[model samples]
Target chain A: MKRTEIRLAGEGGQGLILAGIILAEAAAVYDGANAVQTQSYGPESRGGASKAEVIISEDEIDYPKVNRPDILLVMSQLAHDKYIGDLRPGGTLIADTSNVTPRAPEGARVFELPLTDISVNTTGRAIAANIVALGALVAATGVVSKDAIEKAVAARVPAGTVEVNLRALNAGMEVVRRPATGSGDAH
Target chain B: MVGAGGVRLMQGNEACVEGALAAGLRFFAGYPITPSTEIAELLAERLPQVGGAFIQMEDELASMGAVVGASLAGLKAMTATSGPGFSLKQENIGFAALAEVPCVIVDVQRVGPSTGMPTSPAQGDVMQARWGTHGDHPTVAFTPWSVSETFSLTVTCFNVAEELRTPVILLLDEVIGHMREKVVLPPPEAVTVVDRKKPAVPPGEGYSAYDPGDGDIPPLAAFGDGYRFHVTGLLHDRSGFPTNDPEEAAYLLNRICEKVERRRARLTMIESRDVHGADVVVVAYGCTARPASRAVRMAREAGIRAGLVRLITLWPFPREDVARLTAGARRILVPEMNLGQIVHEVESAVAGRIPVVHLGKVGGVLMTPEEIFEAVKGV
Candidate 1:
């Protein structure tokens, strides 16, 4: 498809904002797609819920805000409740099993990953969960290459944290090797 | 790519960025907000690439503060903000006016008295841009109707600031800020850049930053140039120190306001389309000016003699031309994103000779062409 809307949601400090920017920069600067990313957060930057929406297309984007998502990734319980209903009938919902007990609408496919635990143990940082969740989404949908996501992450995160985030991405991919949820239903 | 001027498709916000750069702007400080954020984002990226310093300030106040500071340091500095942020920068704007600092402030107006709509467009700041700052100081504000005009007016803003020694406000609505159109980048040699006049006397000689000179404007010596002059918002003498004396204060204030007022010919610019032999005229600026032109064409085609007068520079008000143009017309219609701000100016210029009408909409919605046509029917 020439157009895709991806929504990333989680609690604050999960790097959701940075992940959204990385995806936007990758699409615009690297992949040559017209990408516009918007982010909204609660009052707090450390504890409350946060969401970042990225819209990428071959043509120009008019409204930057996303009313519905083609792919919704939720990293916490609040995120799951906030966005699970926003998924279209045949849309994909990727949830971090350690935190999100997702409830999706009928015909909606849900893929579960232990993103929080993997990020915490692999990177020794709970803050990199957003990066791991992105890797899981890339593995499932293949909208963007894994290497592209890795380079985007490295380019955005602090210089001292790049290697750790890469380890977290690999740890997330290992979880994808095992069958945890629905795989294929083209719509 | 097929338009007048090597036209390239670009957004209005990007055009302002290019205009600031072309005007020899070397310093930019701004806090990112919606609708207006693209200007800062573009400046932050393009400024460094062009050997300019771009700093994202903590808030709009600091952003304006840094701009004034950098300008006093002898660099062409500017800042951009939307509604709520614009409110925060008002005090510094007044400060720049009272201090007679030469700089440009771009207010990419959005909806509200508060943080109402982040993405939508509004033109409610018309009166605010004129009177938001608490003072009787003179002002020069310009509004652009197209992407290309945004660049042209911005360059003019810089030139006016240097020539008049005042802070010029570029009043742009959100629609113009987000709209994309074709514009050709001007060649470097074709653009005329104006720099502030420097002190002619030696360092030790009596060089006042606020003294009256040959043209009633003093030569400003840049900061850190061995010139021991001070700048403050309070009334000061020619040597640039604080003074509470009434005569000195009045003299300083009157000169600052009168200089620009006396030179009205150099400050006012207006564009009229098909105004001759028309009974009805539409006065508009910014994004509204674009659709107003079309509405005038549609009206003319419908057998209603209609024309458009677009304000390229709004502050000097184009009073004399507007008065003359509307004097013979049966009616004048003003359509703005706000309710009755610029309409007041039109009503004043007409002075009851012609029936002045207002078509206004508030809270980020633009006045439709059909609505404008209906308003013009009253003539």
Candidate 2:
């Protein structure tokens, strides 16, 4: 089976690290696949666009770090500017229309979503934007099974916020489930 | 969240704390530091519930002191720290070594001469772990490559410390300390826990703190156990009393070194992969082993006969394994996170029998498999 590499990047407090962990757990813990996760550490990760990387494969993961990501999720303009070149030539690019204005790649497929707006509309809090983005990614890519991601979401999110996070997750998933209405775009 | 059945996602540091607890650790004292703080954080909440004690002491020195004191009182004790704190605790660690105290110290390594990078992973402390403390003393260190192995290796650490009545180091790089991985820890019955042997003779009837009594390691008697014995850093005789006599001092030092050296082979642990037949071998440990193994596979697929020797035991230097495993190999490559710390040891172990190539990266990034394979190709 082919290996998939994913990179999630945004501001320091955007919860991309936790999102990376949840995604890895979905693949490895819930779906019984092989996955490895690593995050930027020390000064560069703070007061700047922090980053998290995950690699998933059916075979054993050799190199732990993401050399070139097959999928890139950028939640901020700084992240897009920093990690844009790292995506494969025709890879999938998920951008947050709420903050990022992506400089379109030569042949990349892009999905621009109002992630923060969806989180606000569904959960009444913008902090769940990461979850909403996760849900949308799962819907569009089908990288892991829906059942696997839901189990991971329930297990990872805090107890009191689980219900809302799942609601936010489903709300985000709905955008890609029926994206013809314009909340999400395929360009 | 620990001791849960089946598979679960956990970080390396968290698994280490749970392992120590399962190995009957009942006391912990540490000052929090990057890369290793998670060990102390998890232990603070969990130790008390297990009827153990956890203290966030004023500093790393005090933390080591507390560990030694607690262990002397008959409780399994531990302390965790990073590079800077690790430096601070060296004197106390030396004290524990000279005193023959049974305790565990976990050093989650980071880039450093001193505080170079607080959270970036580096294996710069390899030599420090062996020689940082100020004397000719015995040291045992374990380096685990994965999270699950972190759990089991920690259990082995406590066991070895108690069995030998010596201080042990669980040397962890920052990546292994912080990376979260899927793990299914063994049931309590499956894990082995060792405690220091107590004196069989009646307390006051006949007991010498440093007496070897038919063996190299003297059975340690916990304080307040009605056995009176002295303990000090100064060279001491069988009575545990400080002695300037050259003969007694020489014997005492020899006995301590012999205790660890004699068991070095039995304590040696490693994972060999097609090493005996491969034309080229890579000797790596801890986090570095992951990529080195991958590179070995990459080499073989490309028609290069490459193998790997992943070191589980860093101290006591597995010379025999290195020489024997790579005897047929034409060349040896050593990749490490530091500037050739273990590579030098590998060179020494190989003893010019074969050309040894060194790959060292020290700016806070793990060596990529391609880079390691590139060297294999060059070799």
Candidate 3:
């Protein structure tokens, strides 16, 4: 992409900040592209809204903040309700069906998946939900190669849990490949 | 040139540690504060592995004091802090300035007059970095807009501090300090490393610690070295003894000021683009330069002759360059996170020849490119 802005929004303690850093690393380190990752958090550590913005481009990124996100991935209802209005006209909204009820604006494409459920079922823990969401984000937007994301995850996650996180990532991609009955298009 | 080479994604605070290590920094003492705590945490982890020392002091005062002590013992030392901590460090910073101790102080600024916002960005320390100390002393401050620049400028701050024998400030805001980006650092051997000038005279060979005959900077001798000399905050003569005479005190203070002021031309660093024939010039630094650059591009695309001057070296403020850049422009726009700190300097430089506008944002939110574009169009 010439220049693409991505926003990952969720409540604190969901690892959205780590997900954002991994995505930016995937593009900048593994994909040989330029990327900048910035994050904002509420005063309280947990339960409050947390947002991470990543801007990727083939050239230098001028403005670091995401004014209009081309892709928005949200895992909480509050994040979805707050950030859905900031998506560009033809942007793509990817939300976790387990928590967020999809409310796509006009000309916006919506994709829903059970990101947290898949992580809990595949890895027996909900901590890897952010990695699952990252896998889906890569598959849907093609922002970075799958190999790049996998390498970034391997380098970022703590040792002894890399396998489980990788499994969670692949499970997420599998869900995108086979959409559920009521789920919208994986576009 | 001696680091883990090639391209890697790193945060700004991490880059500062890497840069300090590359500059042969052997000692670090700091107190943890938001937006700047990462630098201390990483240094604590990395310094010991590199055969250096790192100390987490009880507070900012002790941190600065420890850094100064370590520097006097002939190690390149550093400390990092944010708003409140920076305020606490002024006295010791002034001590370093008056005592002619070479050290680097990184102030990763957060929103505040007094604990305003912890995790937010602000350039409010621009004035403090220059004049926070009580007495009149020369100041050298450098600011970077990106992660890679942070690495290079951190090294530069060390070099300048050593060469000039004074404290240097690497000013950063929360936005640049917290952001992550890709950077390709040069090999250790490829980077220029500067060490302080050591004493040439042997012990008891009429060696005076404060004596620099024809030069403003005296050769510093390590404390434990055979060449024993005194160091104090009081104004002293070339023999290293405190002076009560007004003439001797004035000479000592003027020597400190002249040491840096005489080298201002070499110390100033600025990046100017398309400033030759522009109708408006945007002057910005630190994180605000990122959006100011975008605004300049947008204005140019819309057929407005807008140029940009990004100050990489903030203190020893680039007055000559600012005057030359705005000579042909009708107006100048300064967008800072603080309420008109740097704008006042720009106005003084322009001397009312051009209408200088200050676009100040103090709410912890960065000034957006759209806002700057509108300001450019209005100008």
Best by TM-score: 3
Q: Compose the digit string of candidate 1's lDDT tens values, residues B312-331.
A: 77786788889877666788
Measured on C-alpha atoms, candidate 3 has an lDDT of: 0.92
Ranking of predictions according to lDDT:
3, 2, 1
lDDT tens string, model 3, B224-337? 888878888988888888999998899989999999989999999999999989999999999999999999999999999999999998898889889998899999999999
List ranges where model 2 is wrong by over 4 Å.
A43-46, A180-182, B1-5
TM-score of each: 0.69, 0.97, 0.98
Q: Model 1 segments beyond 4 Å from truth?
A: A1-187, B1-6
Q: Interface RMSD for each candidate model? A: 10.0, 3.0, 3.8
- For residues B100-196, what per-residue lDDT tens digits would candidate 2 score against the true structure? 9999999999999887888789999999999989979999999999989999999999999999999999999888888877788888999988888
The DockQ leader among the candidates is 3
Per-model CA lDDT versus the true structure: 0.80, 0.89, 0.92
TM-score winner between candidates 2 and 3: 3
Q: B72, model 1: CA deviation in Å?
A: 0.7
Instruction: Write model 2 residue lDDT over A24-64, tens digit each, in one string.
Output: 98988878887778887436544665788888788877667
What range of 10 consecutive residues in model 2 chain A has the weakest lDDT sum?
A41-50
Error of 1 at B112 (Å): 1.2
